[model samples]
Target: MNARAEAFTRCGSAITTNALTKTFHGHTVLQPTHLEIASGEILVLLGPSGCGKTTLLRLIAGLEQPDGPNMIRFDGEDVSALPIEKRNVGMVFQSYALFPNMTVAENVGYGLKVKGIRRKQRESETKRLLALVGLEDYADRRITTVSGGQRQRTALARALAIKPRVLLLDEPLAALDAVLRERLRVEIGLLLREFGITAVYVTHDQAEAMAIGDRIAVMQRGRIEQIGAPKAIYHRPANDFVADFVGTMNRLEGRVSDGILAVDAEHTQARLRVGGGDRSAVVCFRPEVARLTAGPGAIRARVIATTFFGATQRLVAEVAPGRQLQLDLASSLHFAPGQIVAFDADPQAIIEFEKDA
Candidate 1:
């Protein structure tokens, strides 16, 4: 890590929350929740809209006070009752939130300016932060004069200027276009790891959360459903909701008996070695895990459509009366609609859940 990254690591603080609960007009948006973020870790809170991710973030930032008896701590210091201004935390919002009248440097240095720092020291720190975000040359440019990505960089620089103990981001990249979003996702991930600051990021996009977070907390109905690394969350989901939320999961209805899962589909008798005592179950796997094969004992389906991507071809096929399956194949493979094809999933990759799952 570089000098700037080292500086951030020196100031980073571990955060702990105990029985954190939030209520709005008698409706509890966040239940009694306990979370611990290690120093220099980036934890992403991922869920759908109104899932309490933002509420948890606000509670941590002291923007919204939690119910009594709940505690928020920074490096063992209890800050549950501290207001936003006193918490020494940095926040970045979906809206860039830069002052319209301020130039990039002025905006980045606004925190120091508010704290009554000397002009020389504030200018030096502002210059260093601008360099850290690769916006050194844009210091004199007005906020409206820069691109969306540049404006976001300015916001980040401003946040870091205050030497915050923890960083809170609420869909900071949600406003960018797809191309820019993808590009900045990588850049932001590198920046977070380099800075080594404990961060809590809230987002509804699963891909973004997986790409940027060290670990993800999947939330639902104002509670955390699961918390794990990206690979663990995708491959070993704790329940049905998490399995379906993280990615495209293809499911098949079946009955398990004699160490075999027999799928219910016409023209296709699919059976896999799933050891479950005679009971109804659902076998789920990702689209990429299923492949088109000509071997026997594979599930048969009639191709409905094929969409061509640069590296892979995605085929939508009808497996049963109303059931459809999606499979990703090599782009070189050619198949017309209505053509029958047999596909099989890797036995080791299949996940068996209860019928209700």
Candidate 2:
């Protein structure tokens, strides 16, 4: 297909929810959420267990009902009260959910069969889907005999069988091993792009979310903390929770005063010349922003610990008597565990957030 044709062929439907809220047994499982998932975008809901990421997905899939006021709209029509079967949505579960007695082709063709596609058409579509997932050779293999990756592909093909407008993947990669999960995450992402389906993928794995999502929503305690592109979510988190949860972060709590941020009483500490006023605030800096060098604008620190990765090293240092900070550096630095080092950072790299600011 030509570029435009290929792009046009890969487009799917859009989904949105307004002030979606859910509660269970007097506990709020999903805080009111308003989100717009663009057509053909892969949106990953990421958070720890009990954070309601799955609950939100269930609401969108019409598997869970909204409490009140909240609404789910598909392509501008209200679908909050729609039934699961009538939602035109495909779902892939963590358990693969394939029938043990059915062959791979049978599993892939089951939906088409139920939809009343002719026998010959079902066979042709099954063959095409099997080939699309690179499982054509395993078309007749029983579910029990296929590998986990193959099973995942089978589940995906089966979900795609009915050609639903929206696809919901509920921790689908959780069943695979780490290596296979990584591999399939990429494969599934590619397949979603190829099929042009709008997808809502739920996962707690940060790496998986980063790898597969075009946009990610970081959730906590039934509420979404931030939503943005992967890089924005990682490098420019919305708040302290998002900053600390998405990646390794060092928190310096203090009060911002007179356009400067100070951590402790003795003004001889690493204070940030900020643009905000005096208020209870927290300063955040990623390890990558801290340089292991001695310069005019530097903080003298004592290395407390060092953990080395293949190509990089993470150092935890004491900048003040009781103040600690962390740094990530190249392995070539050759710094010892107990060595005294000077850390420098550009003033602009510092992010200051008032306690209520």
Candidate 3:
């Protein structure tokens, strides 16, 4: 258990949303949805802007009331009528929201001080939190003097100082540069897990979501399209939107007759033995599944371009005019524009969606 866990007498609380929903201007922004977050689990809501992810988080934080009463619960206790303060939930946002006049230690202990915590107790708790976030050395530093990453850490420490039942973060790293955002995301995930806090994180970055979330909930246009572990959500998307949103997916269209699907274009040569009967087929696969081969293979494409990644290169291949597929291969290999290449897709990796899909 964390040292602070003993002080709070509890670490996390299970969150349950029973048909939770939201609306704005007579139109529903968040569709009726049910969600469950396990105690001590980190759940990330991921999607593009205006996807209702933040709306969902606010509802749980008591910042927004759901469409119905008793729709949100914490550890099986109804907190619908409770205000944000009464709910005992801590929030961190992109702006950091620290006081410029106050020192790091004073800002962190501000909440405790407001709640009438004695000076000795508040200072001791603040000291421990600063240590947890690696900001103990900067305790006396003014908030305005710290770097972006340091400021973010101070905000996190401030939120945790209250010993709230649940932690809510809204794009907390969005204000940082790409490199700092990447580094602090891992550090933040480790800190939350070490403290064993049930946390709800909101972000549009897939890599961040994958690294921090125990489970990712992909939302689209006010509804959750898919919810599962990071691997499952990426590998087995519930629909086309989910597949495209999560990662780069190569789609091939062909005709299937007697279990064999052959691409119709004359420039393309792809024949895969599949399960469907005679009909048009749409198959999808990831870029990393393609293997370059010199011998005859199921796929033949004209290499349009190649981008050298550190360990692997991503090649854009045209199986048909204006239809390009991305293939990830070893970085050592070289390909020229308009060069014809043959590669085979892993049989198990190919996925056939419905006809209307």
Best by lDDT: 1
- As for lDDT, the candidate ahead, 2 or 3, is 3
Q: Whose TM-score is greatest here?
A: 1
- Cα RMSD for candidates in order: 1.4, 2.9, 1.7
Task: Summarize candidate 2's per-residue lDDT along 1-357 as a digit string, tens digits.
Answer: 334225335446788888889988899999889999988889999999988999999999989899884389988889888899898788999898999999999999999998899999999988988988899999989989999999999999898888787899999999888999888888888887777678999999988899889999999999999999999998888888888778778777776678666666232466555556667777788888887554444455778888898788899887666677888889888877667776665567776665664
* Backbone clash count for every predicted candidate, in the order shown: 0, 2, 0
**TM-score: model 1 vs. ground truth:** 0.96
lDDT of 2 at 15: 88
lDDT of 1 by residue, 1-357 (tens): 877678888788999999889899999999989899999999999999999999999999999989875488899899998999999999898997989999999999999999999999999999999999999999999999999999989998898899999999999999999999999999999998899999999999999999999999999989999999999999988888999999988888878888677787775687655565788888888888887677765788888999998899889888776798889888898999988888888877888776663
The digit string of per-residue lDDT tens for model 3 on 283-326 reads 88899998877655467889999999999999998878898999
lDDT of each: 0.89, 0.83, 0.88
By the lDDT metric, which is better: model 1 or model 2? 1
**Pairs clashing in candidate 2?**
10-196, 256-278
Q: Candidate 2: lDDT over CA atoms?
A: 0.83
- Provide the TM-score for each candidate, comma-separated: 0.96, 0.90, 0.95
What residue runs in model 2 are displaced by over 4 Å at the alpha carbon? 1-11, 255-261, 265-268, 271-280, 320-324
